[model samples]
Target: MMHNVSHVRFFFLSGFNETVNFKVALFSLTFMSYCVVVLVNVALIVIIILDKNMHEPMYILLCTFCMNGLYGTTSFYPKMLWDLLSPIHVISYSECIVQALVMYSFACCDLSILSVMAYDRYVAICRPLKYHSIMSKQRVLLLACFSWLTPFSISAINIILTSRLKLCSPYIDRLFCMNWVIVKLACFPTETIVNNIVSYVTIIIYLFHGLFIVWSYMYVIKTCVNSLENRAKFMQTCVPHLTSLLIFLITALFSVFNTLFGSTLPPTIQNVIAIELLIISPMMNPLVYGFKLTLIRNRILGGITLQMK
Candidate 1:
């Protein structure tokens, strides 16, 4: 018998059961990792904001990217750290929904921002004379808003639809709440038809976001091939964006495939796959950009030298 949706007050997270013996070690490592993530992302954001020269379109988009990384990781790490210490691994229904909203929106916004970054680069290299006019501060602001709001709205709709279902169980088998996992807990298959439809539509929409990035890069690379100047520009600006995109795609795809098909895998391996995006992408993106971008690297090293003096 399916339970009443109104009575579903909390969810038991079953992923932590196996970690009870090593929770302390896990907590210390996780806490340290979260600290490093925050430190590096914030350092980049601060570098971008403090230097007037860093206020260009590429840096602004990078700041937004790091901000999004912080936002995404914040949703996962605090609760995870708390759960590591607490014996009962449960979350209130409303809290679970909120977590799902932030987590999915964060992921979607990542792809959207990356797409915008690709467009920004394309305009910079392929259409050099029109670059400033096209990627003006006002236009970039508009694009940034679109990147964030569109994904949040789409994620919110999915979460709202999932929230309507009468769930058959309150046990979430993973470490964190996910929109699809919640939908899967619905009492009736017929009730989830709309949910499945909307889910596919949302996936298709982001699939296009991925395609747009590819299209933008194709034009970018072709333009960069002939001119030494454009190739230099590409090495300086576009490489970091490409690296970040590759990291995001790899980690995001791992999580997606693991979610869809890793049921038979060992729980430890499954857990690693699920959290890969959260841990690897968030931590690596800032480091990749910080070290790769010349201006940012000089500013950081200059500051370090000044402090050492």
Candidate 2:
């Protein structure tokens, strides 16, 4: 079979910044974010894995959060930071497709995991009498498996579909190869593909995930209102999740707006917001749970020291 990979030469990037100072600022911010992300996410994963006390479903879900954060960091950071430091900001055509796939694939996976977490919380709370039976170890394992595998299948589908397309030029509008930008570069007329992606993005990525999270929270809240003891513990657990979902939701919603409306927001302002969103998870996630939340810090420390012995 003849390989149809585009014989494209140069991949032109409408990189994040144009001016020297803007580039410098971006470099400083992204570097700091990458470091924080690596340190905190790894620490969270280790803490949860080492601590026997942290082996419950809630904490296990939190551990998956750290892993997802790690995936998120790797998906976007290294190549982007390299571009910031270097003068020539070009990615090979093949590299662009790979990067786009990695970024979106991880993003979709994160959504799946978050949805599982939301449902987990709902089961644990709303169905208290049956909670143990409903969220047994076997069930948790099943949910986890589904969460990781489902998006992976979709990502594979997308990669296979995209790999079949032909390309005339490699000029992409975004700093990186966003799905929107890549689809825009298709040589052939792409109404069906574009519409499919946009509709899927709007419905599944935005609407489905968004609605599920909110619905889960509603059930959680109803359950909480009907309960009496352990109210504070419930609050503690809910707050971190709420914070994570909000950050993710706001960024996704903004991205949708920018794509649909052609954000009149200046590029400087937009890039700044985008950079902050990209890096904020590193600091926010750990601080929200371990540093501020109860039992986590001391338990994590104790768990680490015990492991060393």
Encode model 1's per-residue lDDT on 162-257: one tens digit a residue.
888898788998899999889888888998999889989999999999999999999999998999999999998899899999998998888888
Top lDDT model: 1
**lDDT over C-alpha atoms for residue 294 of model 2:** 68
The local lDDT score (0 to 100) that residue 246 gets in candidate 1 is 92
Error of 1 at 290 (Å): 0.5
Candidate 1 versus truth, CA RMSD in Å, comes to 1.8
Root-mean-square deviation of Cα positions for candidate 2 versus the true structure, in angstroms: 3.2
Error of 2 at 255 (Å): 1.2
User: What C-alpha lDDT, on a 0 to 100 scale, does residue 116 get in candidate 2?
Assistant: 80
Candidate 2 deviant stretches above 4 angstroms: 1-4, 16-19, 191-202, 273-277, 300-309
Give TM-scores for every candidate, taking all chains together and pairing residue i with residue i. 0.97, 0.86
Clash count, one per candidate: 0, 0
